[model samples]
Target: MGCSHLVIQRDFAAFFLHFFYQSWMLYPENESTIVSWIWIGIGILFLTTAFIILLVTHYFEQIRKNKRKMIQLVRNAETECWESIHYLQERDRERLSEELHDNIISQLNIIRLNINTRNGKELNSDLKRSMQLVRELSHNLTPPDLNGIELSDFISDYLVQISKEVEVLYVNHTEQDILISGTIKLNLFRIVQELITNILKHAFATEITVLLRVSVKYLSLVVKDNGRGFPMEKYNKGIGMKNIQSRSRKINAVYKFKTKPEKGTRCIVFLTLNNTKI
Candidate 1:
């Protein structure tokens, strides 16, 4: 009975050893496969995280670049405004000096000469003409009282005066009164005057069309002429054109000139009324 018990115990021991060896052999392959899969998952997660970070960084960089461009554009516009103001001021000074020298001073000198001659009739005539000239100059320098007058009416009267020299057409598109400062009106009038003067002096044009449009948010003035158009390059080099551009900047208006040889010239000015100085 002792021998039979020993044989049974040995057999049980061998079966247990065989089962343990098989389990160990299978464990190595399964463990290796699981480890490889875990590593691959970790690598994929790391790559995805890195890609997300890169995308976020690029988006912020693009935003920063756009902001910088906007800032630069604003700075450039401000610089142009200041330069235009300075140029217009200087031009005005020069104009005043010319008017004094050519009109007032010269007329005074002529009156003085006539007085010394003691010709009553001629002196009377000269004095009257000189007075009239002075009045006109004063009117030119001073802004007319616009308390009861519409801007369109004023412009219409002005066009009528010029119509004798050239065919003039004026059109008004807005019924409501344009609410703007007196200074702005005066500047705009001066700009129109300058343009007309240029057309008369250089364009040799017989017909001119002026259009004025006022809306809730903006005002537009357009001057078109059927004349011998000058080259834009030549126009830019002239002081008169520069003066026009300067005035436009002073009013914070956008000015565009379209011209070609023998075709015609068109000048368009756009002024924003909303939240603007005008």
Candidate 2:
């Protein structure tokens, strides 16, 4: 009877151990519900990621379109500014030329004729001298040299004459002679003349230097002054600067500046030049 009891006890112990092992390995409490929730969370994360990527791509496209629009607006504005400035300068030069030639010169000749007709005792020597000076001044104001001489030589001589009134130092660095068409030379000469006038009137500079250099690729000009320089941010958008910019563009050149208060100013221009002439 004691042996039979021992066998029954062993069988009961083995049955309980197998039941615990199966419960731990095959099934946890509420496993089906937990797995369904995990799959839903993963699907939400994937959708959020895709949406973010789409939004970023759309933002980049908008930025590129805005950049292109901005560039186009700038180009249009520049072109309009050029047209307006060119028109005004041409009109001004034409009117001034006419006034000098037709009105002032005619008046001077009339006075000279009257003096000649009056003859002897009525006219004083001082009066005749004054009339002569007037004629000379008029001629100087409307110089006839623009149409005749080569522009490079003309500019050199012109600068030399201006130097008597204000100090000017210049260098010419082109290897071969430059012979520009009349229209281009006239426009360039007027631009240079304006710059010189400004330097004399406002720069208050003791020294001024101009350099003209040419290479196969480009022709370059530099004008520098040791004087009080203006703020480019304020001055470059002004009417005078606009005029200069238009003229430079007409010549297919680039203009830039370097300046500082109490230090000095430098103006630079670069233009395409043929290899044969440089």
Candidate 3:
């Protein structure tokens, strides 16, 4: 074993000795080519570093431009949002004024007339009617208490009131009181209210059907009416329609209207509560 180990060491030493000798013989011949190749490599390294620096500069510059663009977009969006809020406020005030003038004030004027004519019975009836009108107006203004009831029940209750005037159907495909955030539910309720109001006022239809469907990912509310339909493009210009649009936006919902001249109208709103973006 010792003799074989010695033989292996001798073989390695001889091999290295021959290698150095051959390199020493070749060095002078290859010296200029080797030096030229080294300089070329150094130049390549410098060029690569300069190219990398340029690329990094351009990348950072692009990032800055994108950031500026994003900030400007945000500013524009904030201005638009404020404008929308003011417009909606003004519209709501106008609507309330119109309702007061058209309903209770007119009724009071009639009561005053009855009193002047010395008609006690008619005055009493007019007073009662005015009281009922006031009650209805107050009810419309006050937001419903949603802490105890589910969103479906609140909508269903509204449909029941509307059913007295029009044929109404309410269908819930999910649990009656499914777990949902209060803000999300409130926005949804407002959307439903707006849709029903629009349908009652504009759709001279005989029947209306409301469907609420919930899934793991999202929920959809659909209102369909069998009334004379108006073009959605034109109707969307109205204040009521704008209100619905705004509410849909708040809840990150998508709404579409389907209607023809004589055909009934179907309004669908889809909302995604699970999205953190909302």
Clashing pairs in 3: none
How would you encode candidate 1's per-residue C-alpha lDDT over 1-278 as one tens digit per residue?
A: 33454565566556655754575577866766656655665575566556656766787889999999999999999999999999999877866654444345545554553365456886787678778767876777443466566667777876764675578999899646557656556556656766776676678888999999877688899998998999888889876666677667778888899998787889998988863333
lDDT of 2 by residue, 1-278 (tens): 33454465456446545654565467677566546644664565456556556666777888999999999999999999999999989877754654343333433433343454555543464356446645755564443445566666766966764564457888888655555556556556655665655565567787888887865567778888898888788877664566567667778878888988878888888788654652
> Which ranking of candidates, highest TM-score first?
1, 3, 2
TM-score of each: 0.51, 0.48, 0.50
RMSD of 3: 14.4
lDDT of 3 by residue, 1-278 (tens): 33454565466556655755575577867767666755665575566556656766787899999999999999999999999999999878855654554345545644553465546775686689789878977777543356776778777865664565678889998634356776677777767666666666677788999999976568999999998899877887876676677667767889998998778999999976563322
lDDT of each: 0.71, 0.64, 0.71
The superposed Cα distance between candidate 2 and the true structure at residue 93, in angstroms, equals 8.0
Candidate 3: global Cα-lDDT? 0.71
Worst 10 residues of 3 by lDDT: 98-107
Clash list (residue pairs), candidate 1: none
lDDT of 2: 0.64
